[model samples]
Target chain A: MTTQPHEHIVKSYDEEQRRLVEEIVRMGQTAVAQLEAALDVVDRRDDSAARRIVANDDSIDAAERRISQDVMRLALRGPMARDLREILAGLRIPSDIERIGDYASNVAKRSIALNASPPMPHVAGLRALGLLAAGQVRQALRAYSEDDDELALRVRENDAQLDRQYTALFRELLTYMMEDPRSITPCTHLLFMAKNLERIGDHATNIAENVWFLLHGDRPLPPRDKRDDTSTAGPA
Target chain B: MTTQPHEHIVKSYDEEQRRLVEEIVRMGQTAVAQLEAALDVVDRRDDSAARRIVANDDSIDAAERRISQDVMRLALRGPMARDLREILAGLRIPSDIERIGDYASNVAKRSIALNASPPMPHVAGLRALGLLAAGQVRQALRAYSEDDDELALRVRENDAQLDRQYTALFRELLTYMMEDPRSITPCTHLLFMAKNLERIGDHATNIAENVWFLLHGDRPLPPRDKRDDTSTAGPA
Candidate 1:
């Protein structure tokens, strides 16, 4: 049977919808890169880089607003099954990206608060956590853009690993504070920075969940046990 | 002009839609109450009350889920103009409510973690902050339900007050930590609890913004500032 004109229009519409989803994923990846760069600023005490991260947040926020508008427009215009899920999922991705930008800006602010210096003894594990979290965020976005549920699941699983790293990092910092009471000032700020990275991991997990919801129409993972994950472990 | 039989059915459908919106507002109110109860638990270190708050979250969660389903069903069936906006707003409200619940749970968790004995210094200010935040949340929900822009704006203003309180509380806690290094453990948990209440205020502001959006179809408030309002006050 010959294709109907309206059907052809819908086919093009689907293409446009897919492109929008891809754009959101790209935006997420950009935000993740910004976060990683902010971590570098934290390590090097690069005030210029920190300021750049803070300023760049506006672009991320604008992207989020644009994506939200596009999603709402798409939903109002009406979408079919798969396209509907993709567009709805697209709405949440930008919020996650914006939050990642917030975390990056947090690290930047902390960097400014604590002037540039050599890596504090307890910061190595925190740095590792940041690198791992950034990687997971990027991977989650890639999995989403490519429609790879297996990759998304892998990204989700890495959240637990990130939590373990954070637990270890916190314990190390706690030990530092216990040994030298004066270390509390920088250590508290460092704790917040670590928390920002952990929250980025959480945003990645949220993205992974969105990917799963788009693919399967249900939450794919069990609710996490906060106690098991957030509790401090033995000295690192 | 004679009305069709289906017109009567549509009228009844509209009634159901209105009821659904009412239910959503109720869910929002319940969430605000949960936050208040959670604050009480934190202030009094009443673990039983905290446990009750935790248990109560499931009910709020279930209510939110039910309202979400209703919104989706109504949207699937078809909604026009005001009905469409109301349903969409109804959908957004629950997610906000669920986040409020999550914040309450965070407060409860911190309460459990701290387990600080009576004479909990630095707590009075935190409790005041929670009460202030809880009030904003309640007023915001009422404004949304009543379509009262004036009340919504009031809620927005209250957010700044909550921020000021959070700053004072943080400074007080910092002093406690500086005075007695051993107080750091409980103080740190108290800090997170206070932070959670402040965040709850932020989310309440978000709800008020959404309410304004629903009423005016435009964002009425300026975008949120990314700075740490808690840390910025000039050393208490």
Candidate 2:
């Protein structure tokens, strides 16, 4: 059977939609790379690299603004189910990306302050967490671009692992402080950095959750203790 | 000169607008009081009070939401310049109020974890920070209500004092860790709690900045340097 004119228009629209999704995935990857670079700067005390990351923040900010504007424009133009989901997902992805950049910049600023000092104890654990979180960010973006629901779910699973790592790191840092009080200064700052990474993981998982919602439209994940439904406590 | 009938309507609308602004000030005071209660729960290890504070979150949220909706409705109906600024200020105060609740809940969560343990070192400082921040929140709300730009400016100035207090508290905790490694556990948690209070102060300052913005419609405040900017290169 000959293809109808409406079919041709729909095919073109799908292609354009895919293109937009791809752009967002690329932006996510860029943000992940920025995180990695910032971590490297922190690990190595590379002021030059840290400065570069700081300068690059404006670019990430601009990218996020542009993506948000584009999403708003496309949404106003009317969208089909998949197209609508992609557009909404696009809007949220950039916010996560922007926050990731923010966390990276924080690490970079911390590095600048450390001024080439030796890495604190548990630095390796912090790096590992950073790498894992960066990887999750990239994988989540890929899953969204390909509409791979399973990969998105895996990204969500990884957040728990990151949290566990953070908890362990926190305890280890505490032990170090218990052994030697002098370590407290660097250790406390390190704790904040670790918390920041854990927060980034949380945000990545949030993005993954949004991806899941776009695909399945389920109720957003309930607070962890939904079964403790003593709502008589009311609305907290 | 003969009076226009429309002038009478306009005069009554102005009176109602002023009354709405006053209501927002009252609401803000209630929110600040709620935050103070939440802090007391933490300081006193009062679980029931903590639960009550958590329950009160919904009321704060609801009040803020209602005020926001009201502002939008009023703006849409064509508010004059002064009324418009007052309404916009009203809209912003709730966000600051909500954030205060968030900080209080954070303190409560930490209190729950402390589980009736004797107050940690610098617990007094944390309480001081909370009180100071709660005071600023109250002052900012009152400033918005009365359009007292000078009072708002004074509230903004207090953020620096909060920062100074936070810095001192952090150093004291470091000394504790140095004195005894076991102190690390409670001190680290307390550090996080202190940071949360400091952040609440920062948020209050942010609200004050917005108040300034509303009053003058000028460029926003200069970005404050991040507090975690201290270097590990230095000796504890």
Candidate 3:
């Protein structure tokens, strides 16, 4: 067999590395989709949607496995400095995405639990807060796939506001639980769902930070929001 | 210069690899210590321990930075097959440990919030659960440091038990919140603390799984437990 000059055979290393990045991007999209479905379940009490979200997590975990393999292969072949960080990015980004997927699944589980309870006050607030969280995840992934630090920084900045809103929502839910004990059960699931959303936002910020590190090398990241006393009511 | 028969006195890419592993092991110790301190804060409402845990997180971050650098340096220098996996382990394990540290800080923050509120019924349960979570982290790290698949498997298996205990604790807290609305506030804080502990357990399992992958090559990890329904009383 005569071997012709091959134009497509190149990029053995680059292709696998690219696949690792692409796989993570796909995983991020799936995670965002999962979050949307999970939030929808919360809003609609749709058991099927919850089931779908929980089932989708396996694919995200699978994507992480694929990325891990690609990273290992490329690492064994040895990478340049930049390639090394990219490989590290391959490792770091997926775990955050996977964890985000887990948070979405947790939200889905809460949704199933919420199915039995009648809707409580401030349930509407969750829908609004969820939009914010979902937006953060979307933007964070965009920054990751496109390597846009501006969008990543925006994601990081919005997380503080997200945390503040979460604190506000937690306070209001507590008030509802205090006012109507009947609200306690649904409200309890809602609070955990809200906390899960806030955590999803944190994971999004974490992805943003990873993107920053991937692009910027060893530069120090800005401090994430530390203000926890945002509730108007003093702790009692 | 006292030059011996050595070809060159330089990092043969192996020493740095070992240091990378060593650095992660040291970071693991610090993270477990932080968890211990954070749990102490929750148990005794020790303000100083809480502050110490919060402050200690920066060092863990620093530890992660060092590991990241080591990983990058080794990858750039190029590594053998085994060394490459070890380097990849350096990249993955530190992120999980760092997140555990962050969870510990969250527990510490909740501890401070609970400082003002009177102690609720399940506070002791948190201490017990914290021990379990802390022990898991320690054992997972031990598996990581020693490359012990059996111990890592044990860590993974025990996470289900941890989740079940968490479910039981959540039901009890919900009952307390329903019975006395005053327990609502402190119970709310306790619930978040408990959630943080559950998450820490999840991360420990993650580390154990990473250790498994690092030692045993690519393989399918079993499905983690998905049970969420454990509350005795139905919602609302």
The lowest-lDDT stretch of 10 consecutive residues in candidate 3 chain A is A227-236
Flag the better candidate by lDDT, 2 or 3.
3
Better model by DockQ, 1 or 3? 3
lDDT of 3 by residue, A118-229 (tens): 7665767887888898899989988988999989999999998888888888888888888777777888888888887888888888889889988997787777666345
User: In candidate 1, which residue pairs clash?
Assistant: none
lDDT of 3 at A151: 91
Residue B98 accuracy (lDDT) in model 3: 89
Off by over 4 Å in 3: A1-19, A221-224, A227-236, B1-14, B82-84, B221-224, B227-236
**DockQ for every prediction shown:** 0.31, 0.19, 0.42
Q: What level of docking quality does candidate 1 show?
A: acceptable
Tens-digit per-residue lDDT, A114-144, candidate 1: 5533457656676788999899998889888
Candidate 2 CAPRI assessment class: incorrect
User: Model 2, residue B67: displacement in angstroms?
Assistant: 9.9
Please, what are the lDDT tens digits per residue for candidate 2 over residues B1-236?
69876787677667766766776777667767876886787678787777777777678766765665554445434324445445445555665676677666666666665544456757788788788878878788777776777887887887888777777777787777777775666676677777778877776776787688778865555555544334333334
Weakest 10 consecutive residues of candidate 3 chain B by summed lDDT: B227-236
TM-scores of the candidates are 0.89, 0.70, 0.89
Residue pairs that clash (backbone atoms under 3 angstroms), model 3: none
